[model samples]
Target: MALVGPLLAVVVLTAAPAGVKAGELPWPKWLVAGVVAAAGVLVAVWTPLVKARTDALAARTTREAEREAQAEAALGRLPTLKRKALLVRDMNDRALLGIHEAIPLPTDSDSDNTLSAELPTYVPRDIDADLRAALEARSRTGGFVLLVGPAASGKTRCAYEAIRAVLPHWRLLMPPDGATLNEMVAGDADLKHSVVWLNETQNFLAGEDCLKASMVRRLLADTTKPVILIGTIWPTFYDQLRIRVTTADEESEGGHAFDKDARGILELARRFSLGKWSDQEWDRAKEMQSVDPRIRQASLHRGQTGLTQILSAAPELVHRWEQAETPFGQAAITAAVAARRCNHPENMPIAIIEALAKEFLTDFQRATAKEDWLTDALMWACRPVHHSGGIAPLQAYGKNMGQIDGYRVSDILVDHKSKSAPIPDGQIAPDIWETLAESATPQACLLIGMGAYSAGVLGVARSAWERAANTGNAEAMAPLGVLLHNEGDAEGARTWWQQGADAGNTGAMTALGAMLHDEGDVEGARTWFIRASNAGNANAMTNLAGVLYHQGDTEGARTWWQQAADEGDADGTAALANFLYDQGDTEGARTRWQQAADEGNTQAMANLGVLLANKGDIEGARTFYTRASNAGNANAMTSLGMLLSREGDAEGARALWQQAADEGNTQAMTLLGIALDREGDAEGARALWQQAADEGNTYAMTVLGVALDREGDTEGARALWQQAADEGNDMAAQALRGFIEVEE
Candidate 1:
C-alpha cells in the first residue's frame, strides 16, 4: 500500500504538468525503493529523516516543474484579437462568427430593446488610439508598450480599441489581454515595426497581477520593436518621474509649464469638446449656470453650453427626438428619465442608454445579435469601476447621479417597474456570472465572479504579500520588495529581498541590489546584482554597470556595460557613447550613438542629430531630430524650437520652450529666458533665468550672470559667473576673470 501510494502520488502530481509520458517517470522504482527504504529506516533509526528528505525532494521537484510550467505559460500570452487571428490561421478557418458566441443572451427580457444603450462607434477613442496604433504595429512585427493613465483615463479603452483595429489580422494569435506583456515586447516594436501600448501600466508592472514584466523586459531587448508606454500619473507622481529631457525650446515650452492653478477639467472639456457649441446654445448655457458649480461644471452637457454629449453620442433617432433646449427642456428630460427610472428601474442601464443613442441601422449590430450586444454592454456598464480613482461610482444610467428618484427624462422612456425580485439570489448569481463571463472564456462560468474579484484583488494585492513571503512564494516577494523600494523603504524591503533572492526570485535580487546601490552600498549591491545577472535579470546588469561607472571603476563599468548593452539597455548604449567620447574615441562614440538612435532612444536621436548638425549633416540631423520631437522628447522640442526660431517662427518657438519649462526643464527655461531677453523683455528673461538657475542649471547660471552683467548688476553677475565657472563653464569663467580684472 505504501509503495502504491508513492506511485499514485507521482502519477497524480505529474499529470498537472505536461502529463508524464506513460512509464517515462520511474514511478515504480522510486515508489518501491522509497517504500523499502522507509521500511528499513523505520526498522532502524531514520524514518523521520528519510520521509523528510523524500517529501523535500518531491516538493522541490513540484516547484521546479511548476516554475517551468509558469514560464511556459508566460511565453504563451497574446491579446484577445491576435489569438482569434492565430486560431483562424492555424485551423484553416476564415469564419469570425464565433467571436460573438461569447456574448450572452438576455433571459429576463428581450435584449433587442436594450441594445440601444452603448457608446456610439463615433464616441472618441483617443484614450485608446495611441495603444491601438501600437498594437496594430505589433501584430506583424511584435513589441510591448507600457500604457499609463490616471484612473478612468481609459487604459482598457485603448486595449479594446487595439482589439478592434487588429480584428482584420485574425491570423495572428492574440489573446484578449495578450499572452504576456513580455512576449509582446520581445518583438522590438516601435513606430516603425510594431504598435505596443500598455494600459494601466502600473497594473502591468511591478505588481502581483503582472507576471509579464520579465518577458516584457526580454521583448524590450528586441531592436525591431520599440514600444512607447502611455500612462497618467498624479501630478506629484509625474514630478517624481525621470525622463531625459533635451528638446529645442520651441518644441519644449507650451504644454507642460507649472502654473499655480492647473486648467480645470471643465475648462479642458470646454476647449476640446464644446468648441462646436452654437452661439445661442452657448449663451443659454451661460444663463443656466447653476449656483452649484459642481453639477454645472461637471456634466459634459451642462445647460445648453455645448453639444449635448448625450446628443452627440446619441443615435440619429434620439438626437432628433430629444431636444434639451431651455432650463425647462433639460429639466423636463431629467424629470422624465428619473420618473421612468423609478417606475422601471430594471431597464435603466447605461447600456440601454448607450444602445438607444448609437447608430442602429448597421449590419454589425445584426451580426452580434443586438440582444447579445446589449446584454454585454449592460454588464460592462454595471460593473464597478475601481480604477476611476475617486470618481463617484458611475451610476448605471448616465453621468448624472439621478435614479428616477433624482430626476426624470422626457424622451422615449421604458418603465422599469419591478414589484419584487424575480428569482432566488443563488439563481441570479450564476446567471450574472454566466452572462458576463461568456464574453471571455478563460474564466469558468461557475468561477467567473471569483476569478474577477481574485484578479482585481491580486492585481493590487500587497497586504497579503508578507504572508506569502513567509510561506516562501517568489511572486509575492518580488513585488512587495518593489513596492517597498518605490516607497523609499529600502531597508524595510531587504529581509524579504534576501529571502526571495535565496528562493530564486530574480526581481527581488535586482530590486534589492538597486536599492543598496542607490544608498551607496556598492559592494553589497554588487553581490546581489551578480546573482540577479546570472539569473537573467537584464535590469540588474544594466544597473550594476551604472553603479560601477559612478564609482569611477572604468574597466569594471565597461565590462558590465557591455553585458547590459548585449541585453538591450539604451542607457548602457548612451553611457558607453558618452564614455567613449570623453575618452577621445569620437568616431566610436558617434557610431555607437547612431546605432542607439536608430533603436528609438529619443535622447540618442537628439544627441546624434546635434552631432550630425554640428558636422554639417543638416538634413540627416533634421530627419533624426524630427522623429525625436514627434516622440515627445523635450530636449528635441527645445532644439527644434530653437531651429524654428532661427528660421523666424519666434512666437512658435517661444511657445514650445514655454511648455518644456513648465515640465521643469531648466535648460528650456534658460533658452526661453534668452529669447525673451532678445525680444526686449529683459525682466521676463531675468525671471526665467533665475528660476532655471534655482533648478541647478549651470547654463542658466551663465545666462543669468550674463544678463545681470548686461543689466549693470556687475557684482551679482560676477557671483553668478563664478558659480557657472566652478561647474566648468569656460565662457562664464573667462568672462568672470576678465570682468574682475583678476587674470592677465
Candidate 2:
C-alpha cells in the first residue's frame, strides 16, 4: 500500500514526458515538488504501521501457545478431577485419608451382593451444616476450611462431602507434600475455582518447605482468582500449632517459640471440630443399613462403639492385635501400644520396639522365642487386616530413609486402649518408663517429659527429663530443675540448674538466681542474674532489676527495667510502671501500665485499675478490675470488692472478697472481716482477723487488737499493738502509745 503512491507518481511523470519534451516541466516546479513530498509522507507513515501490525500478530500467536501450554501443565498438576461422588469413592484408596475405610461385610455365594464392595453410606455429621456453609463461602470468596477431630472421627470425610456438595466441579490439586504444595501455590498455575486438597494438614503446615501463611493470605486476598483451601487435622496438631507463646515461655530455655506461620494459617481457617457420632447420626446410619451391607454391620456396634469407628474397621484392627496367633507378634504390638501410651513419638524406631518387646513376653515365651522372632513380629504387625484400605495395628514406614525406619501404631488402637484405662500415667509400670527413657532419642524424651508433665505424671516426667538431661540436652535441664523444685527436692533443683547454667542456658541462670535470692544468697543471686541479663535474657533483666531495687541500687534498677521493658517483657513493663508511679510520673506510669495490661499481664491490669481508682475514675477502674479478677487476680478481686461495697452492692462485694480470701489474699481476708463485723458476725470477723494477722497483715493486727480491747482482753490487745508497731505500722504505733499512756 505504501508503494502504491510512489509507483503512481512515476507513471504520471513518465506519461507527462511522453506528451511533452523530455526534461521539460509538465506543471509548475512547486506543484511537482509537492506531489513527490506527499507520496514520501504516505510511504513514511504506512511502513511502520504495517510492521507494527505484523509484530502484534506474532505476539498474539505466541501468547496463545503459552496459554495452551499452561492449561496442559495445570491439568497435569491436577489429575484428580472427576464427579464429586466418584472422587469420594476414589478417596477411599488414599492411605492418609482422614476417614478410615470400612471393613467389608461377609458375602454368601447366593446373596444379593451387588453393594458388597461399596463404602458405607455417608451419614451426615452434626458439624456438616457449618462445614458446608464454610465451603459455600469459598465459592464466593476463597477461604481455608479446616476440620479438626480425633483420628477416624470422619473429619476428612465431612470436609470431602461438604466440598462435593458445594464446589463439586472445582479441580482438586492434592500436593504429595508441603514442598510441592508450596511450589504449586507459588507458581503461575491458574488456580481459579480450584480446591487445594490437604488431607493431613500438619504435613503441609509443619516441617521444611511448609506452606506459609503469607502465601495463603495472598491467595485468598485475590477475589478475582478464588481458590478453596480445604484440609483436615487432628485436634492434637491443631492445638500444638495454635498454642500462644507466653512471655515466660519465650524467655525460657526449654520453651518453644510459637509456630507463627502455622498458627497464622490455622487462624485464617474457618475451623470445625468433629466429635463422636451423635445418637441421631447413628439412627440415620441405621436407616441406611438396607442400602449398604457395610453400614448394616457397623450399625450392629452402634451402642458398643462409635459407628464411624466401626465403619472404619477400628474393631477389626483391635481384633487383629488382640487375637494375633504368634506370641512374638502380640508382644511387639503390646510394646508399641505401651510406647504410644507413654507419649512416645509416633515413629517408633525398629530397634527400640524390638528391645521393648522382650519385656512384654512371659518368661516361657521369651525362652522359647525363635531366632527370627523379630522378623515374624514385624511381618505380623505390619500385615493389613482387611483386603483393601484398612490399616494394620502397626505399619512400618520410613523405608528409604536410612536409620529412620520405624513402625507407626494405628491411632484407632491407641484410642481404643486409652478408653479402657488412663494412659501414659495411671498404673504404668516403672519398667516401661525406664525402657522408653533409655531407648528414646533426647528430643523424644523431651516430648515425653512435656506430655507427662501436662498429664500430671510427674514421675514419668522426672525420668524422661533425667535421661534427656544426661544426654547433654541443655534445654532439658531447666525444666528438670523446675520439676525437682516442685517436688520439694530443692538441692536437686539447684544441681540441675547449676549444670544448665554451666552449659550457658540463660533461663537456667535466671531461675537459679531467683532461687538463690529467695534463699537469702543475694550476692550469689546477683552474679547469676548479671550473667543471664548480659546474655540477653529479658526475664533475667527484670529479676535483676527487682534484686537491684531491693539492694538500694535504684538508678541501676531503673536502667535494667527500662531495657527489659524495651524488649517487650510484660513483667518489666509493669515494674517500670510501678517505679514511675513511685517517682510521681502518673501519666508515664499509666502509659506503661496500659502497654503491659494489653500484653495480658494480670498484675498490670490490677495495678492499672488501682491507678484509675486513685484518679477518681471508678467506672474505668471497675472495668480493669473485672478483667483482672476474671483472670484470677486476687488483688484485683479485693479492689473490685471494695468498689462494689461502696456502691452498696454488699452481696457482690462479699462474693468477691470471699473468693479472694479463699485464694489466700491477706487484704481480702481483712476486708472480709470488716464486712463480716458490720453484718453482726463478730466471731467470724474475729476469726478472719486472726487468720490475716497470723499472715503478718499489720492492718489486720491493729483491727484485731481493737476488737480484743473491746472484749476486755487488754493484755492481748497491747501485745498485738506492740508487735504491729515493731513492724512500722504507724496506726499500730499510735494505738500502742495510747494504750501505754492509759495503763500508766
Candidate 3:
C-alpha cells in the first residue's frame, strides 16, 4: 500500500511532457513543480523501506531453514525411539538379543538362526502384577524400577514385558554408556515420558561420568514431565551398591570404597526380585509348550535347570566348554574362565588370554601345537553352534571398528563355574598370578587383590598389591600395609605404611599414625594425623581431634571435630556431640547426636538415648535404644535392658541382656549375672561372672570375688580382688580391704 502511492506519482510524472513544463499542462507552474517535487520525495523515501522489508524476509527464511537442519541433526544423534513409531518386533529383536550370553545349541541348520531370534511364548511369573503396577505408577510419578536376579533368571525379559504391557506408548531412550546417558539427562533434550532402558545396569552406574544420585534426582524431579528409568542388574552388583562403606571398611584390605553416588542412586530405586520359575510358573510354561517348540524342549529339564536358562542355552554352553574337542581350544577357554574368576571379568584383553592359555596346555599339546594354534583356538572358542544367533562359549566384544579389543567369557559358563565350587585358595596357578601381576591394570590388580583377600588367599593378595604398588598406585599402598599388619608382620607393615605416607596417601598416613599411637608414640601420631587432616582426609581429622582431646587441648579438639563434621563424616559428628555433652551444652549435643543418628551412627543413637533417659524422657529413650539395638549395637541392647528392668519388665529385660551378652557385651553379662543370682541360679551367675571377668570386666571380677568369698574360697576371692584392684577398679580395691579386715 505504501508502494502504490509512489508508483502512481511516478506514472503521473512520466505522463506529463518534460519540454511543455508544468504550467502549460494543468494549473500554475509553481503548483506543477510542487507536485513533481512531492512525487520525487515520496519515491526516494519508499524505495529503501521496501528493500529493508525484502531483506528481512529472506534472512528469516534462511534462519528457519538452519534451525530445521539443526533439529534433524539432534534427532539423529539421540539414542532414543519414539514409542508410537517403535515397532514391538524391532524392540524384541534388539532388547532381547543375547539377553544372556550362553552356549549355542548344536544344530544342522544355519548357524545364524537360534532360539533368541524370536522370543519364546511368555509365561507370566508371580511378580508380574506387582512389576506392572510399579511401571504404571512410574508413568504418573517418575521413578527408578530395578529388577534384580542372577544371570539367565529372566530379569530383562520380565522387565521388557512389563514395560510393553503398561507403558506401550512411552518413548524408549537407551544410551550407549553412562556418560551419554548423563549427557542426555543434563542436556536440553525432552525426556518427558521416556523409558530409560538400562540393561546390565552396573555398566551405567560406573566410570567417571556415570549416572549419579544428583542426576537421578534431577531426572525424576519435575513431576510434570515424568520419566521411567527401568533397569536390570545381577544381585551381586545390587548388593555391592547397597552396602554402606564404613570407616573400618575403608581401613581393611578387602574393603572397597563403594561409589557414594552409585549407592545413593540405588537407594532411590523401587527394587523387585525375579527368581527361578516356581512350580506354578512351570505349570504355566507347560501349557504354552504346545505353542512353542523351544518351551517344549526346555520343559524336559524343568527340575534340573531354570526354564529361562534352558531357553538361553546355558547348559549347552557349559557342556561345550567342558567337552571341547581340541586341547588348545579348551586351554584358551580355561584361561578366560580363570581370568574372570580372578576379577578380570569384563573386556579381557586377548594378549593376556593368549599368554595364560599356554600355561593350561599339557606338555604333549604344547609340543605338538601348530604355528596358528592360537588363531585356531580362538576361532573354536568363538564359533556359534546354534542355527541363527551369535551364541558362543567366548563372546568377543569391541569388534565394531575392525580391531578386536577383548573377549568376555560367556556369562552362563562363569555362573556355572561359580555355582559348582570356588577354586580353592592357592589352587590358582602361579603362572596365572604372575601373568596377571605383570599385565593387569593397576585398578584391576587392586580388585584382584581385594577378591583374593576376601577369599583368605593372602599370597595372591600380596602379589596383586605388590604389582599395583610398584606401579605407584597410592590407593593400593595402605591396603597392602593392612594385609601385612593383619599377618603379624609389624615391621613390614610399618615399612609399607611409611612408603605409602611419603607418597601422600591419606589412608596410609592415617593408618601409620594410628600404629604409632598404638606403640605409645603420641607426638609422632599427632604429627602424621595433622598432615593427613591437612590433606582433606575426614577420618584423619577425626583421629586428630581424639589426639588433641587426650592431650587436654579441648578447644583444639573441638575445632578439628567441627571441621570433620562439616565434611559429612558421621563419626566426627558423633564425636562432636560427645564433646558438647561433656561441656554441658545439652541442646547442642542433642542436635548433633540426632544428626549423626539419622546418618546411621549407632553409637550416636545410644548416646542420644542416654541423654533422653537422663532428662526423664523414657519413651523417647526407648525408641532410640530400640532403633540402635535392632541395628546390632550391643551397648544399646544393654542400656535398653537396664531401662526395661527399671520399668519392672523383668522378662523383657533379661531377654535383652541375654541377647547383648551373646554378642559379647561384658556389661550386659555382669548385669545378667547379678539378675541370675537374685533368681537363685547361683551356678549360672558364677559362670557368667567368670566369662565376663575372663574378658577383663572389672565389675565382673568384684562380683565373682564376693561370690567366691561367700562360698568360703578366700584365697580365690583374694586373687580376683587383687587382680581387679591392680587394674584400677576402685570398688574392687575397697572390697579387698574389707575382706582383709574381715580375715584379720
Candidate 4:
C-alpha cells in the first residue's frame, strides 16, 4: 500500500500536467513529497557505510592469504632442524641407531678410538651359551633373557653385540626412563621384531612403587608379541629383591604385596650372570691387537696388569727405585697401610701420607733431601689420569696432589683368609709401631693406634690410644671413643667423645653428633654438627645437610651439601650428585660422581660406573668399578665382574664375584652357582644355591626346586616349592599348581 501511494502519485503526475497532477493526486500533495524526500535521504546515508565494510573484508582476506604463503615458505627452508626435532621425539627414529648417536661415550685414552670396532669383535664368554639357548628356547615358549652383572661388566655391550649377530637388520630401542618405556610399549605397534634393551635395569626395580618393574612384568606376560627384551641388572640389587621376596612375613598385611611384585618380576625372566674379564680373556683381548696402538702399549704396561700382578710388580718397582739399603721403601709401605685404614684408602689425604713419611725420615735421622725419600715416588704412584675437585684442600693446596690411586696397595699381601695381617713392625721395619707409640706424642700415638688397629692388633691399638689419652690428647681421646663405639659401648663412646669434644677435637664432635642422631636427639645432633662444621669438618657438614633435609629445609640442605662437596667430602658429593641425577641434570651428576669416586668413595664409584655405562663409556666405567672393587666394595666387584664377562673374561669375573660372595653378597653367590652349573659342577652349584637360599634368596630357592624336579625328585621339589610359595614366590606357586594337577 505504501508503494501504491508513491506509484499512484507518480502515475497521476505523469498522466496529467505537472501543475494539475499534484492537486488531483489520490494522496495529499505534501505527504507524497515528504515520502519521496525521506527515501532519497535513506539511500544517500547507507551507501558509503556498506562500501567501507566491503573494502575492510577484502583487505582482511588479502592479509590472511599473504600470511599463509609466508608461513609455508619459511617452513620449507627449515626441514633439517624440523626433521631433527621431530626425530628426537619420533618412535621410528629410535630404531637401528648406534650407541654413539644415542649417548656420549668416553674418550679418555687412545683405546677409546677403537671402542666401536671392539664392540663388533667383542667375544662373549660365560653367558653366551645360556643366552643362545634362551634364544632358541624362547622361539617355542616365548620368554626374554636378563643378563645380570656388575656396573663395569660388559652386559650391555655383549647384549648389543649378540643382537648385531642374531638380528642383523633389526632395530634397537633404548628408552631412557620408565615413562618412555611405557609409551613405546603401549603405542609402538611394530614392536614384535625389534630388540629392546634396558641397561642398568635396577633403576626400574628400586623403590616401593616400581612402575617400571610393573610395566616390564606386564610386557613379559603379554604373549602376543615375539619381542625380545634384554635387560642388564646389577647383581646386588637383584639380590636385594630376592631377599625381599624370600624373607617376606606371610602373615604380615603388607608382606604379601611386596612379595607378589618381587616374585612376579623374578618369574617373568630368565637370568644370565656375567663377571669380570679373566686373565685368559685379557690375553685374548691383547691378541686382538686392537685398532688403537696406544691401547696395546697400555695393555703391555705393568700398571695395566691384573690387580694381583700389579701389586706384585710394585715391590719390584720399589726395589728398583731404591737401590740403597735405606728404609724409605719400608716407610712408604707403612704409610700406605696406615692410609688404607681410613674410611677408605682414597680418603687418606696426600698431605697425611706425606706427613707420615716425614715422621719416618725424622725418626731415622736421614738427610731431609726432597729426592732421598719416597714422597716423590709415592706422589707419582698416587697420581690419577684425571684431576678431581673432591680432594681435601689440605691434600691439594700446598702439594696439589691429585686424588690417590693407591698404586693397588690394598691388593698387596694382606691376609684375606685369616683377616689378621701382621703388624707394621713385622711387615715393614721392625719396631715402627712400637717406636711411634713410645714417642708419647698425640699425633704419633694416634698413628700407632691406627696402624695397630689395621693389623688386627687391637690390644696394641688400645694401649697406644690409652697412653695418648692419659696425656690428655684430644685426638687420642676421639680414637678411644671410636674404639668404644665399635665395641658396642655407646655410653662409653659418648663419654670419651664428650671429653674429646670439650678439648676442641672436631672428630669427636662429629662422632658425638652421629651418636646423638642415631639416638633420635635431632636438636643435640644439630648443635654438635654445627660446632664441628664451624671447626672445618667436611663430614660434619655432610651430616648437617642430612639433618636439614630431614627437617624439610631442602634449600638449606642443598647449601650444606654444596659446602661439604666444595670441601672435598665424598658423601656430600654423592648426595649432591644423586640429587642432580634425580632432577635430570645427568651431566652435572656425572661430574660430581666422578669427583667423589676419585676421592675413594666406593658408592660413588659404583654409581659413576652405572652412569658411564648408560652413556656407552664402557672403558671409563670399568676403570671406576675396578678401583672400587679393589677398595673392597662388593657392589663394584659385582659390576666389574659383569664387565669382565662381557669382554669374554669369565675367570676374571668369577674371581671378583667369589670375593664379593665371600663378603656376603648374595647376588654374587647366585651367579657363582650358575657358573658352577655351567662348568659341570652340579653338586657345587646346588650347594651354593642352598647357601644363598638359606640366606633368603627366593630366586635361588625357585631354581633349586626346578632342578630337583628335573632330577626326578618330585618330593624334594614339592617341599622346596611349598616353602617358596608360602613366601609369595609366583613361580613356586605355579610349580605347586602344576604338581597338584599331575597328582590328580
Q: What does candidate 2's lDDT look like per residue over 224-249, in tens digits?
A: 88989889887766776665432231
Which segments of model 2 are wrong by more than 4 Å? Answer: 1-148, 154-272, 278-312, 355-371, 399-404, 418-431, 438-443, 520-538, 544-633, 636-662, 675-691, 708-744
Worst 10 residues of 3 by lDDT: 37-46
Worst 10 residues of 4 by lDDT: 36-45
Let me know the TM-score candidate 2 reaches against the reference structure. Answer: 0.60
TM-score of each: 0.44, 0.60, 0.62, 0.37
lDDT of 1 by residue, 689-731 (tens): 8998886676577667766665678889889878977865655
List runs of model 4 lying over 4 Å from the truth: 1-461, 484-494, 502-504, 513-535, 543-557, 680-683, 686-744
lDDT of 4 by residue, 109-195 (tens): 545454543222344455676687676566433456788764335566566666655655544555544445544443333445546
All candidates: CA RMSD (Å): 24.2, 27.9, 28.8, 33.4
Q: Give per-residue CA lDDT, model 3, range 338-438, as digits (tens).
A: 77656564778888788888888879988999999988899899987575677777877796787778788876665564433223331566567767666
Q: CA lDDT of each candidate?
A: 0.43, 0.68, 0.68, 0.53
Runs of candidate 3 exceeding 4 Å displacement: 1-98, 101-123, 132-146, 159-232, 236-271, 283-301, 355-371, 398-402, 418-443, 489-601, 604-632, 640-744
Please give the lDDT score for candidate 4: 0.53
Point out where model 1 deviates above 4 Å. Answer: 1-473, 476-503, 583-599, 742-744
